[model samples]
Target: TLRPGHAQLAQTARLADLEQRLARVEQAVGATPAKLSRLGVGDHSLLATAQHLASRAALLDSAQLDAAESRLTTLLTKLDQVAEKTAAITGSSDPDRDKKINELYELAKKTEYLSQVLPQTLERMLALQELHQQGGEFAKALSEIESVQVQLMAKMRSNGETLASVEEGLKTSFATIKSNMEALDGRVKALSTKK
Candidate 1:
């Protein structure tokens, strides 16, 4: 329903708006290269850092990995040598080892039993000494004897306790040593079999 003059005016306004939009798009496009250059600078630094890290990783793989492998090989060799030396010293087979341990254990038990029984024996001896000392003339000598006997019993008890403790310690130590040796022997056998 518009007249010819109005239609021409509307078309001119639309064309002007389109031209303004085109100019703005051209301005953004013109600025794009500068923005990309700034981004490229950041990317270059990041790429350099990544390359440095990669080189370090490669160095670690070549140097540290080889060193670790060599150390492990050396340790294994030493273990093998120790195994061989142990076998030589202990002999290829020890049938008496367990028997000896059992005998030592039995001896320790007997020693412990004797230690316990010794105090009772000393007490009985003291009782007998007291019965014999009822006469006045022998009283002083009996007193002296009793004192000496008491001191002797005390010393014996202390020595017995110490001996028992020492024996127990030796027993525990020997057992631990035996266990460790057995474990080592098993490992050596396993390693030898593997080879």
Candidate 2:
């Protein structure tokens, strides 16, 4: 039931959220390129990927489908590396680390799924272009494509919300685990001192 205007608003909001998250990620990843390098993740490439995604989002907003499609294709090629990085990070043997890594993996998979949806959206746009060139009735086609775009935007918003929830949950779990570890360490130290 999303209108085009509503869809645009939703897309814009999600893009803004994505940009903020990307910034946070860049800050984290940039702070420790050596750690990522040790894990075989090219830090430069990750930053580049984020920039490319931001540019593609801008292009999509401007209706530059061809350019956006090219960018998207390039982005898709980088997904594997990102996923591998996530897997490597998750492989560390830490209690809360596993949960956080799993969240990251889930987010990466969702990103891949979203990328796959882009090609289909681009295809529809291309089809609409062809219809327009034929000098025939393209109104219905446009409407249908717009509807598809709305649905895609809705799906993206839902995924974004899910990612946010996972991140929040991870933060809470980490706090709890850290508190318990601190208490246990204190108890052990006290007992050792008494002995």
Candidate 3:
């Protein structure tokens, strides 16, 4: 009887120790990403909200000014949070964290490009929405936005790949990307003459 009780107590103690270890692991996992940590200790709620807003915008069938305005408002709010957190972590507007981070940057620049192109796109979408409201071609506006988005995505992906190839370090940085492999060669020639 005594041996059985001792074994049970030992098992219970082990369980408690396991729980404590799990809690610590959870904290470390939550703290791993600095930008996310800045937002809060363990709630990615706002970033999720922004993602939801973007999803909503994508699902929206028509380009009503009100809908676009709502999406823009949500995106701007989320961007503000991300920018604050990222700037705190990186200390610069452009933070080069890693290859994946570089990909994100390229993708973001593509979105910015879309934002620039959006006024015109929005105007077209608005016009089509108006046409739809009055019983004209409403579906076409959605198609146009989809097409532009697809093209924009492809371009960003291409740029990301290209940047990744050349951005490894001085080890991989090429003179060809500088408009001439011979540019360095010319510099070398000039240096030789000076010596």
Candidate 4:
């Protein structure tokens, strides 16, 4: 029997993860204008994260995936709507960046899937190795798994920096937009006062 608090904690962790993922997507989409134009170092992972979060909502369920699937689906739908609005403003000039972004997204999705699985596997393994799992050194040795696991974790982090860069770019864009709006509004007020 699972305690209520245990389930709540899991939900909290999962929601935090989902929110973090959403933040990454917002940052990526915000940076698309520049990233697609220049094809910078972190551009691949940035765009990939956005594409994955948009596409993967269908494969998840509320109970198992720990995402409120409906909310995610709605969020993706809103992104599609936004895309429709500005579809013509942005063009993917850098085909190589676009391709790399797709590849990165696929890799990120695979890594996320594995991360969700490995913990369950580790829990089962712990039960079997309990008595022998005592030594800190033994735990450390067990922690260092195969090369594949190491690679996945590294790749995930590699993606994080890209996401962070995207976020910064987006915030800067937002500030510019706000400043432009304020300028326009001030002009409107001046014109009205003259009238």
Clashes of each: 0, 0, 0, 0
The TM-scores, one per candidate, come to 0.29, 0.29, 0.20, 0.26
lDDT of each: 0.81, 0.82, 0.74, 0.77
- Which model is ahead, 3 or 4, in terms of lDDT? 4
Clashes of 4: 0
Stretches > 4 Å off in candidate 1: 1-137
Worst 10 residues of 1 by lDDT: 40-49
Candidate 2 Cα outliers beyond 4 Å, as residue runs: 1-133, 137-141
Please give, for residues 1-195, the per-residue lDDT of candidate 1 as tens digits. 999999999999999997687668656554344543554433233334446567777868867889989999999999999999999987876769868988999999879978889999999999988777666548888899999999999999999999999999999999999999999999999999999
Q: What is candidate 4's local distance difference test score? A: 0.77
CA RMSD (A), model 3: 46.2
lDDT of 3 at 44: 51
Leading candidate by lDDT: 2
Worst 10-residue lDDT window for candidate 3 reads: 40-49
Q: Which lDDT tens digits does candidate 3 get at residues 54-157? A: 77667665667669789999999999999899989977664445667889989998788787888998899999887778663456777888999999999999
Q: What does candidate 2 score on TM?
A: 0.29
Model 3 clashing residue pairs (backbone): none
Which residue pairs clash within candidate 1? none
